[model samples]
Target chain A: MTEDVPVKVNGLNHWFGKGEARKQALFDVNLKVAGGSLTVLVGPSGSGKTTLLTLAGCLRDVQHGSIRLLGQELNGAHSDLQRALRRRLGFIFQAHNLHGSLTALQNVLMGLQVHGRSDPVLQAKAARHILTLLGLGDRMDYLPDNLSGGQKQRVAVARALVGNPDIVFADEPTAALDRESGATVVQMLKRLGQVRGTTTVMVTHDNRILELADRIVTLEDGRIVNDTAP
Target chain B: MSLLLQALFGRLPIGWLQLTHNRTRFAAALAGVAFANVLVFVQLGIMNSMATATLKPYGFFQADIMISASDANSMTEGSNVARQWMYQAMADPDVVAGTGLFVATVTWQRTDKALGLTTYGIDPTQPIFLSPEMATRAATLQLPNSGILDRFTRGLPRDETAAIRPQSPLSFEANNITLTLYDTFAGGGGFGGDGFMMVSDQTFLQQFPARSSGAPDHILLQVAAGADPDVVAARLRDLVSDKSLRIRSYAQAAAEDLSYQQTKRPTGIIFGFGVVIGVLVGIVIVYQVLSTDVADHLSEYATFKAIGYGQGFFLSVVFEQALVLGMLGFVPGLAVASLLLWAMASATTLPLAMTAGMAVTVFIGTVVACSLSGAIATRRLVAADPADLF
Candidate 1:
């Protein structure tokens, strides 16, 4: 599990616009995420935590840094290469972002569909298995609108993990859930990271789940202020 | 390939479901598309109806060959030919039978009622090439003072008994023509309103005092079996050396009639412009609706991208949605246009024929518009960053 870095960002700096409009979103950020570990990034509002997470997730263009996930450099990748790289990375957001028209099971199956996998039976089976693991077995047929907030987040988590990506990036996934549901989601994410041996990076403002993370990184302004392993 | 199929077909149901889920938005979009179709189809139907009405009178002339002046492009602008031409045509060995006819617009009055009517002068004794039904009508007609009034004008009483006020002075130089009713020809109206009369040459000259020299407008000829109409037409052309006189077979006349309608009448041009406007409106509406929907669900698209959905998959969804909306709107629009055409047929003398070709053309046009709009609107999805979901 400790053999190599799952995500590496070298002197990453990102700014929005130029001149007077220029504002640094990420500043001289350098970090390494070890494989098969649950890393939590905690920060206050406007701390540029999301910017750093987006850069590491290959969702944004780097202005003055190098970013590599699973040893593939994303600094100058073409559009197609970037898409391929994105297919190998799973992302979860504060909102479920589940297709309101699709059922929970279908939402999970969409993960495989995004990767251009068309085997519906296999996809369905994997989706069901993931939902069951996430304690959402009974809600598979419910649409996002029909499910409770906690169930919606769980479905989103299942969607992220269903693709079997090398790394999972979650941005405030538990922000919209109650305390108990948030804890359950964090615990489930941690368990999946350990069992699947996949790197998990979750950005959150909730400190209650800090003990559940294998490592905690705090962000102040746009730089990492503290890194602690427990 | 399977992935594309699944995304195209499988995602289609979801897209439709989403559309249906939002009843208000879906209805608005459907209404916009349907209105566009209605506008296009109605304009086309009216154009067809006008063309049909203009050509209805000639439908009965079954002669394989006809000769008229080259400048007489349509029924409205035909030129006069001498009765001697019919006799000259009959001299050909291949000529079976021929007749001389004159068509003109004339003002008629009985008592006080006066109106303009299309008047056809034909020799009733000869085997005229006109429809048998019209011939029967011509045979049964009673010419008052030697002039026969068509069924359209027959409702008016004779000049002696009628009490209606005349819009024009009643003039009967040689004889007074009494009105008589007969069977009506469908869509027989000419450039003017739907009132026409048929009469003998002598009665026509009597009723129309302005025609000091009576002349037939055209010659109708019937070729004997095994006789080539082209050869007879050529001979007629050679005999009539004056450039003002040109010979045309019935086929040539029909072709010329179509060309005249296509070029001279504003019906085709106006309707063509209508169709273009409909297509443009459809594209704009479709683009706006689909673009809004895509923007509303942009996050979901990003999530799909994050999970690995290809750009092709996103594009397929947009296309499927467009097709669904187009089809949904098309069926109702066609039905509405057909209803309007039927209602119009009853109220007016125009003949509106909605053919399968028209339907096919309209459907193809709608589909193309929708597809183009969807393709343009989905460009944002292609440039979207999947990692934005994080």
Candidate 2:
């Protein structure tokens, strides 16, 4: 692996439960993601795709091997280090996870605020710019409850991108959108990654998203079965 | 609220957002806090009333120092101190004048109800009343079997007030003791008695034939100009070899009586427990609201954790909510308690005012209670695992 790779995973393993119920979730997973590459983890259920994504994102403890995110090793990383590293990353979960009491613009701003402090005016401007890019310019003040399912999912995507993170981890990013909105969000993610050198590692089953990926790593039963760049 | 929180922390008030999102839950939580505040305020007010009532009789005198029987626990309940103590106190150069005070709680029958009339028996010659009007009015007790009644007594009827004036005396029989009310005063009712009446030493002895003139319940003495009452009292304590008498400055006696009533009386103990119960109820209610809220958004909290939000940020939100509930709830609770206390003071003639000290204490207590509940409620949320959010 090159020294400049943004995400480098070597000999990674994971397990769940204890004693008689203990079961392995991943087996010696190894991968290197270059800067600005859109790498899609494609696998069936229980294939440990999410487990690898979380380990690489520094979202969980690395139980067995070495995983470096943004040149810092994740194994035995202190909480302050993990937290500082997390500030440079973004995430899009399947559930959208928008705060019900906050408006669309506020939810998007939360993405930027985790980095400590910034100009509130600039933060709002950046959030508005991102929300508008996702075709939610008019719904910026609407709470999550008032938004439709597709609108909420688009807002989540906007939040993950508004902070201008160096890297983004997404799970089923376009699962709730219609074809037009879905295509728009996918195009935005691709443009941001390619032009701005924002690395993206996503666990997705969307065929359109997979086709546009710079690299695809397929997994079955916790081990990578295929890797191709085409 | 969001704007206010933003101003304070310059960050998203996640706690305020979560609380306000569910309108019903927030209102219920606030109401719980308010109820607790009201409970504390009212109990404190009742305790205040106990002290006020216990020291009511002390207000009737202008003495710099007082001598009571050692058996006296409060101003109202005591046996007798000999009149010779008064004569002994008057001899000192610091002592100008003194009076022997005889007290007896007599049961008076008012048609269907029985009331306690605390009758003060005093010498017509010596002055002890704080009120100049009362001192003049008390002189009328010099007339045979005549006395002055407390017009502000709790159960005194409207018709009796009109009938018992200085010009028109109302003759009545209390416990087969003949007494004619020639005047009235402003000393209100208290826990010690439903009313009070003053009489001459001769009339008082006639009313209680078994009692003697040599021994009175208490002795009140006035000190000379610019002399400290405590110093005079100390001098008297040294001069009087009687170990069975309690000698102190009048102010010290009243202060001790107030504390004794508040700490040692059954009313004080029961009201103190009321305050504790109120705090506990408040904690439970707030905890239920906050805990349910945390549970409902477990997945979202896990997502926040994954998004690089620290435990401190989350805790800030919950504590902000706690502070909001405490401060806002105290407003309505204090207002209601004030109105109730004022009404009670007039209707029952107990000195039950809502003091500044009581208000400040209850306010701090409310904030602490709500914060404690918030801390307990956030226990599970702080442990939210970002790994399981998927």
Candidate 3:
């Protein structure tokens, strides 16, 4: 019932494939993420860091054990209920998954549209405001194909932030960005946490932004081996 | 209506945008759909024209009821019916007038083309066929070796058809006789014959010289204004009581002949096969286009699913694309079909015309075809799990 806890996991387990080919990806994972703070998950490849983040973000079904997201238990939850929770959270993928055909502004507007149908002018204003804040104001009309790699990732950040979601789950959001752009994205997330009480769970191995995190959870072999305040 | 407009052009234009984004792919899909539409339209058009064109000669027959040889299956296959059947049909109270006509096909040689021309021998004194040209030239056919040539002959030389006037000599090469053309009439040529000539009974006998004089090919009867032709025909059938006579109202007979041509003839079957092939081709082409589109956009759709957009939203987008293809594809199809039909009609003198009903039917048919393809292609999108984003 604690509203300050944005995400909590206990005995979390997940597997990939089926039959004899099946392999366990996560085993006995446990964690708690605080509200109004930036929590980064650090781990090597195939260590189940992305698996735990996606489970917390409702991107995949919780196969075993309990995951409480935004104060609602996700274990055995109805698909519709899970989808409802997903709308309150934002996701930024490792590849900066913006539609190639859509303009920068249109890509941001897609975030707002998924929430519900609203006045188009108001939606456009919101999308424009987020892009401006992310330093993409000048490239609002440029399609993803025309934008550089760093600019495209910034647009993805703008899209994830346009809806003002309660929580943001980012998977390697800065992988495609240069030092300045990567720092800009981390600073923006920190500002959102401080100003709007938004919670952020980012999965990244970049050490440059690790110093700014309020807390860091390190996963090794599907288990959280380290949890410490910076 | 305003809400629907917004759905189509505003909030829901994602389908349109996505389709239009790849210009080459969009153009290719439109071409595929249009080709299928054209195939169906032309096949149905020609089939419809065949049924209508063959009825052209019957349109000239003014009788409400007709008596033909009992075993006769179609207009061109008339056998001998004893002349006594006509007199017997005239005895019915509903019969106001009656006439007997003889039909035979013979070799016709004009300066331009040599082909078989069907000849109708009409009693000069009786009102046999209702034709504007015949009203003026009926009696002229009573002269020896005189007949009226049909003006609208199939594949006839345009110049010769125009130049042959009254008193023009037409050689009946089969009988070694040359018949003088009394005049030209409008109705007579179609599937029934390449061309036709109307002559008096005496002239017909002279031209053929082999046909029996005592029997006629068919008996035409005019019913009283208040009497139902079906009832009159039934009465005439009973009155004649001759096993060799088959009596029917004009409408019933024409319907029978049309049904036979559409279902039993090779031309009709070929056209039906063409329509089936058109639909099959549409399925294959549209399936390829939509399948490729879904495959290209699978990741985007997975993102949509991950972001809380339900399966219903993506499905609507796909169907919207289908509807656009259906409607836009029809434009080129209709344009091309109308041009082809005009050319066919001019070249063959067939009664082919595009009706508003035909356009609407083909458009609806195209929508159904494309929608079916879209439905099949959407399976890939539906199987896209948001888990792929991880």
Q: Is model 1 an incorrect, acceptable, medium or high docking prediction?
A: medium
For candidate 2 chain B, the 10 contiguous residues with the lowest summed lDDT are B125-134
Q: List residue ranges in candidate 1 displaced over 4 A.
A: A1-4, A224-228, B1-8, B64-71, B78-99, B106-117, B125-128, B135-176, B179-191, B195-203, B212-214, B221-239, B244-249, B379-390
* Top TM-score hit: 2
lDDT (C-alpha) at residue B325 in model 2:
82
Q: Calculate each model's fnat, 2 decimals.
A: 0.74, 0.62, 0.54
In model 1, the Cα lDDT at residue A198 comes to 78
Candidate 3, residue B309: how far the Cα is off, in Å: 1.9
Residue A17 in model 2: lDDT:
90
- Encode model 1's per-residue lDDT on B1-390: one tens digit a residue: 324434658642556766776889999999988888888787777766666656666775567667676677776576676667667777778888877666777666545666567776666666366677666655543344333343334334335323221222123332355443333432234335555655665556666666633356777888889888888888877665454665777777777776777667676576667777878888999889888888877887777776666778777788877888888889888998888877865555356656687788888888888889889989878656665565
Model 2 lDDT per residue over A1-230, tens place: 21258899999999989999999999999999988888999999999999998888778899999999989999999988888888788888888988788899999999888888879999999999999989999999999999999999999998888878888899898899999998898888788877888888899999988888999999899999999986
Between the candidate structures 1 and 2, which one is better when assessed by lDDT?
2
- TM-score order of candidates, best first? 2, 3, 1
B1-390 in candidate 2: lDDT tens per residue? 778988788888777888888888788777777887777788788887777667777777688988999978777677888888888878889999887788897676778788788888888766554457568786788888888888877787857765788789987787587788998887677777887888888888888988889888888888989999999898888888786789999999899888777778787778878878888988887778778878887877777788788988877777888888888889888998899899988888887889999999988888888889889988979667877756
Chain B TM-score, candidate 3? 0.89
Per-model C-alpha lDDT, please? 0.73, 0.84, 0.82
Off by over 4 Å in 2: A1-3, B86-93, B128-133, B231-238, B355-357
